[model samples]
Target: MLSWVDGRPAELLSVRDRGLAYGDGLFETVAVRGGRPALLERHLARLAEGCARLGLPYDATVLRDELLAFSRQLGEGVAKLILTRGDGLRGYAPPQPAVVRRLLLGGARPAYPAEHAEQGVRLFPCATRLAEQPLLAGLKHLNRLEQVLARSEWQDDEHAEGLMQDASGRVIEGVFSNLFLLKGGVLLTPDLSRCGVAGVMRAELLAQADALGVPCEVRDIDLAELLSADEVFLCNSLYGVWPVRRLQGRDWPVGPLTRKLQAIARDLLDC
Candidate 1:
């Protein structure tokens, strides 16, 4: 596994980096196949949006080139790009004329269980709730303690992913993925206006659904609503899509819609 700091091979990060000090950074986890990054445009789009929201100085063109080169070097695996506000002094105020730091790490592609996609996965109902923070709601920022804790809640193999919710008890998403549900032949996803990461795979599905003339909605979803759904699935850039079949004693069949979207996602991930 190779790591790059500021676009060069290195393993050390500045101790004064604000990403370590105050979680002032953003990141993207991209899948690479055949020496090419998968869904690169969507990943870059999200990174650009995150940079704009965080006021972090970034050049997408330069980063894109670096990403391509890095993926080429990696050949096939996952590339994690961490963009930080760079080094700072001994206080909370950001340094004047901040220099952004780009950290990229390469790792082996995850080997998720075949049944996770073929049959389905069970969701652990996480007790950890996401706090409402409209400012950082949709950005995949460095602050991920909530997800870290939620993921830590479950330690068994039976649950493949944990379901998270907002403080208001509204269904938010999975700890590591976005959630989707089909109700009355309509596709619905939780709105990220208040919390949760707006994942690239989630965005791709929304667009794909629209192109296929499937009605879609992004709005607040409660546990009751989610439990009543006709079909459910989880998605992320890494593993494509997994049909969610069990959660909190309830079970769902791996339906036709889940399979359809799964195929679309497989194509997108080139898996």
Candidate 2:
């Protein structure tokens, strides 16, 4: 494992760090290959937006250069950048002239079953419902208890991912990936404006769908609509894309649109 703290090789953090105490931080999980990071610009862009939304100080240009250099040195794997508001005194009040900390860590890339992408994976409809917080919606912040609970509901290799929903029973996304459905040949992904993480790969696929002359929509998706869909898929930065072959006790053959988008995602990711 490779780790760097504030641009220096170190492993220490004050217990009073706001990120630890109150989940006050933002993180970016990047995929690296051949000594290069994939969708780096997009990840940085989202991180900067998260920092702004959370009122945290960040320098995109400096961070970009630092991460680029770090990714090159780390080579192939996963690089996670955790930016926190540094250590603080007691209470929820943020301190003055906060000293932001950047912790760069690396891990081995995940190796999933090859059939997960080639043939489609099963989905477990999670019982955990996400609470709507427009302020934190779509931002990859430190808080993730909802996903943690949802993920805990299943523990078998048969299901590669679990689907999450909002309090109103509207399907939001997968526990770790974004969700998309195909109905009558049109592409539809849940609107993340209210809940769920706004995935970088989902954004890429939406663009690709448009370029392919396929109709795409971003709105609410109910359980019935999801179950009735012609095809379904999940996406994230690392896995690229995975079709959902089974959900709600029903099975679906990996449809043409899913294959087309999978091909598009592979081309975009150069994987």
lDDT of every predicted structure (CA atoms)? 0.94, 0.90
lDDT of 2 by residue, 220-253 (tens): 9899999999998999998889999999898988
The residue ranges of model 2 lying beyond 4 angstroms of the native Cα positions read none
Give the TM-score comparing model 1 with the true structure, all chains together: 0.99
In angstroms, how far off is 235's CA in candidate 2?
A: 0.4
Lowest summed lDDT across 10 adjacent residues in model 2 is found at 262-271
TM-score of each: 0.99, 0.97
Question: How many clashes in each candidate?
Answer: 0, 0
Top TM-score: which candidate number?
1
Over 158-196, each residue of candidate 1 has an lDDT whose tens digit, in order, gives 999999999999999999999999999999999999999
Which residue runs does candidate 1 get wrong by more than 4 Å? none
Q: Assess the local accuracy of residue 108 in candidate 2 as a C-alpha lDDT between 0 and 100.
A: 88
Q: What local lDDT score does residue 261 receive in model 2, on the 0 to 100 scale?
A: 81
